[model samples]
Target chain A: MSDDVAKFLDADIPDPTDFPADAPGLRQLDEALRCTMCRELFEAPVTVNCPHGHCFCSMCIRTALATKDECPLCRHAIREVHLRRNTAVEDAVRAWGLARTFVLQVLREKEEAKAATVASKYFSGKPKSKKRRRTPELSSDDEVVEVGERNVSHSLKGHTSSSSSGVVPCPICNKSVPMQNINNHIDQGCPSPKDADLDVLLSPSSKSKGKQKQEWSKLFQGGGAGSATTGSKKGKGKSRGADQDADPLPKIAYDTVTQKRLREILEELDLPTTGDRATMSARHSRWVNMFNANLDASPSQRKSVKQLMLELRRWEEAEEKKKTRAKLDAKDFDSGQYQKDNKTTFARLVEAAKPKAPKKSQSPHEGPPASSLSPSDGDSIAPPRRTEVVTIED
Target chain B: MFEAGPVSEADFFTWEALIMGPKDTPFEGGVFAARLTFPADYPLSPFKMKFDPPLFHPNVYADGTVCISILHTPGDDPTMYEAASERWSPVQSVEKVLLSVISMLAEPNLESGANIDCCKLYRDNKAEYERIVREGIKAQLGL
Candidate 1:
């Protein structure tokens, strides 16, 4: 069964060795060779050297590193040492030539199956995203508010992929998810092994005892990593007058409630409310002059304005992080990934290039069918000169 | 970034590499020392690696920097044969590149290389090139 499925995927992939012959245990190494965002073979794959697989594409990984050198997928510490190519894998590849053809047929078959499944669903009337499937879980359809602004109509269609049937039970752990989701699992997306009631990934001592050790360390000024990041700035960091200098334009209609709200917002960051008492008194005196400007808007509008600012800040930070990760992956992703193996060709190459016949000859049961389009171009790849076009793989 | 190379007599800008005759290939048991001169923009630009005792092969450059697709810099090349990924980039290190070079010596991608004379000699005039390669390997190995 494993051979069949492996053969299927390999049938098309140009470089068969790129996929782990034994997947489960080497998931991290496998994931490291691929791009996280693209969910395919990397154009320039980069590895995050974590004991637990926390791999991401180089470009994504590098962008994330700008904030900190942590793997984008699982936040593991990334060291330069992890950047070395898997030489054993490379040697196997140098020997393998190009990928096979049968793997492509299975992939194509899988695609057809998925297209068939999507067409049968009730939501197919309108083209909707997979996220919209099984809408609202509401019995009364009219009550459920559709997601979107006034102009756009929305539809929900849940989708299952084509490679659904008889996927090889993952060789590593007996457990198997779709092959497409393997990298995610390896890179933090995989349910924590500790999450399984059956297996304890880390012994209980490692978790609780480690936490206690951290707390003791924090007391000694070793502080948490976040604090350490702001390290060596004990004297020169924040200004001494920082607390007293905040909310300078105070008493502008500084009603008790408004003052409380402002205090609540500012206090989140432990900022100051006012300067000297004289400064406070001056602001209060000016309250008579400026109260209307502060209070003109309705309370909800003011609250909403604050919320909007907070939300915007959150989005901006997230965007910044996203861009950082993207840059990292771009910079590092696909560094060694050869360009010939896009998923389609990768699957095809794998199929075409399988070891002529694995030990036990099967009943020849018409293994898998060929692609409908008929690769009239034939099996040869664009000769070695054209070998450098990097393709993202799954 | 600068560490003394493994072999003595090897310089940083131009290091000496002992290319072991790949086992079972036509150039077997032959020890070939080559000169690898990295450009100022090396890792970005392809490094020039040439046999000290020059010999004939299809993919080798006239000056002896490897002309394999993997060694081409991923920049605008006047020739359209190589893709950006196939070209050399700063990310590539000496180890990976040497691996590719070794592969090229064994494989000799003849399609793109226009060294028709050397290629013809290699394919049709096999006995001659082999003898030359074998003798060059002898000089490089000091054997």
Candidate 2:
């Protein structure tokens, strides 16, 4: 018996290359595997007596179901004693695996042969030179790249000089122009190269939210800065430098409303917040980063992403609050619109807004029954009391 | 020693009897049989039993009778009815009753007997008592 098992394990497999490229049997196995409920490789398999030859895991067929039951795949009723393991099916599986390995090996050999043919043509060829090569002799990287339809002279035909300030590389035509022209290149793939510097001053003054404009003048006038980097503080007044008056608000300020939104975003994202001073600065910075990412989107796309974000924020708030039952305000009811329904009023403009609860329509299928809430049934409303006395010594 | 027996369980249960007459006893050279018809509540109550041929032994009754120990109803013999050993118990089987009868034939305890006249006859007139018992055995055997 041991010898027989060893023989079975070492059973010779035929080369799968011998089968045609479109072998029907391989296709059948793929189709069969797709149909298998476990969607895994077959194990101790059994075939019921049904004519279609549907197979199943033998143990599943035997124990996962009832005694003397029908075959699941074919619906053919069978006796418990009649179910038999199909050793022949296992032999087919082994043969299939061997065939697949042999076929893959054959394909690998074919690919190697093709690679050798391509190598011989490239490595065995001689290089071209300026004199020995004929006029039309081929094989030049520069000429081939140019011939790949760069048409560089024609590409620069209708344009001259960069208009924008900082140098921006044009992706196509391999040209470096300027930043303001990037939108032009992206829009029409051609940038007018002029008017570059006037639109490109560092406008810390123009962005003057509060005292920022005066602070810039002090920066130019040379203030408390260590060096006389500014021209001179020579004739400045008793009042401190304008830079001192500056609040140093960052270029992007998260206003109270946006800051509140930012905290909701961070909390929704479940980022860990440290209670110590060391991370308090980082937690504040993270709020700005998440806020700008939502706010500074292109104006058209901005509304939807922000809306989705806030609605998702609301859902997350609802989810986190789910563990505790909602407390109804003892004095407060939803006078319903006064209950912050306006924040959601803009939401309906976007199609994905949460639908408001429809006004309570008293369909017969719904609402309080007519039998109830009537004055005659008022006395009947309260449940009867034949209270059973329950007591415990403990 | 007496011991309990198997429950008599069947549609209609019967007891198998095999009694022996002891030697040198007044009722020797004879084997007798008696059927004890017990009610369902046998040990809680009494049974009606009698011998085929009545004898004139000290423990036997005035009629055709075999009076032995281990056959009285349950509880103290309130009438001071019979010797304590003669009353029945749940543990007493047919075999134990047959053995008791054999022992009674050898040496009868007449002090606590039901038939007072037979007890007196055995003590006063042993020859006459033996003769009448022998005659009863003969009639039973039809010899």
Candidate 3:
């Protein structure tokens, strides 16, 4: 979990090698990386079994499944258990998180160097033609140096000077300043840190962030390699014979086991056992998946058994609510009650559906045009349109 | 998104899109053009998808407006034919809607069809339905 926290903490550092977070290009990239639910860079990204290829963070999907068992983007049926961690997307986001600042810094420095060369050319006593030819070489040399610095930074743990000269590149501004004056340059010359950045990085809430990360990582390591493969293989099993790798949890045969034994098992796992036999079996199955899945997560994302139990309860409640809602919906559409409530509306719709004046050319099989389709039948039991131009605003 | 963009830069609310008829369907080889009109409170509510020149499909109206469960508003459905899960929510984007429309074209929902004639034709006479839809596609392309 320290690794996860370290990654975030590193993001707080204003590195000269990175792009400004607010740059237009970075903003566009941010949009692509953001989860639709949280509107933040994806954390534990999971792709649903929807045809639209929609992705949501694990926490977001859990929250969403609490209310609806469908894809948010396409309204296709989906299950939290069926969600596959989008490792490719997760890797991309992780890579971007580390590389954004370095890439941006290189681009900024390159542009600045080009501007400096142009200014020097104008001010110097050199001929325009000679300066033009030399400027291209300088710019190309600058790019090579930038690339070299990037390669060095990736390989090295700490910053390294490009030259052994007394001057060293300031990590904050990427400016070559005397090694002794580097601290002075950062304190006096560099621009003040943005207020938003300070608020996020220096906030009091982040004080205990390290502790939480430690706890999460501890839980993650407990589950071991089987859990890791289960997390990765869960969603990739679209074809037959992949079910064996889908669930890491050992399936308990609730039917064969006595109720007392099942209750004991739930107690040993520290899961709730208040439900009936059927409910208990379902609850236990969900808990096993949740527990093993948490093990598959990175240290920062692993959930405690208590949290998993709560999630299981929420899922059960949502399922119960859906069943009741379906029952109510069926009851609401009772033919007798519907006709009694909308008799007048139905009469008008039927009347409107009839041909206004019989035309010999019109065939019975040819349905009425959209304009003639009764407004009542469009979406709801709304009143029929009396005129052609009765456009209802959404 | 779906090889679709706004018809004009100024009016982003309305978009002109071209959906390549999905493979393995009667609509294959046809490039169907349509218009998407998004509401101001989009994502919260679904946008309206209408074919430029009417499409002959069970789920599509004669005036080109498409009627599918995905386009319906979230929450309690007035028609009760669609489950709440099947309806639109704030998370739905224009890209998802277009993809759903394309899939709908390939596999029309005859149960709650917007076009009764097309629905009957599709159920009782699939050959005729395919022919009519193909002809409509050809007419749209002036072929």
Q: Which ten residues in a row have the lowest lDDT in candidate 3 chain A?
A: A381-390
Clashes of each: 67, 6, 8
- lDDT string for model 3 (B1-143, tens) is 13556665334456766666788899876666677766543444577788866688899898988898888876656768887767887566666677788899899998798999999999999999999878765665546
Chain A TM-scores, all candidates? 0.20, 0.24, 0.34
Worst 10 residues of 1 chain A by lDDT: A385-394
C-alpha root-mean-square deviation, each candidate: 24.9, 44.4, 17.6
| Model 3 C-alpha lDDT per residue in residues A1-394, reported as the tens digit of each score | 2443344335443322135555657656756776775554676788888888799776556556655787876778887767887777866765665466556655566555556555655576365545456567676466556655565455343333433347855553344677666556554533323335433433335432444233333332333432454454333222223322444456587889899999877655544456578877877776665654554444333433334443454465544544554565454658887789999999999899787656665533332233322222111111111110011110
Question: What's the ranking of the predictions by DockQ, best on top?
Answer: 3, 1, 2
| Shift of residue A120 alpha carbon in model 2, Å | 94
Candidate 3 Cα deviation (angstroms), residue A19: 15
Comparison by lDDT, 1 against 2, better one:
2
DockQ of 1: 0.04
Global lDDT for candidate 1? Answer: 0.41
Ranking by TM-score: 3, 1, 2
Model 3 misplacement above 4 A: A1-33, A37-98, A103-394
* Winning candidate number (DockQ): 3
lDDT score, residue A119, model 1?
A: 52
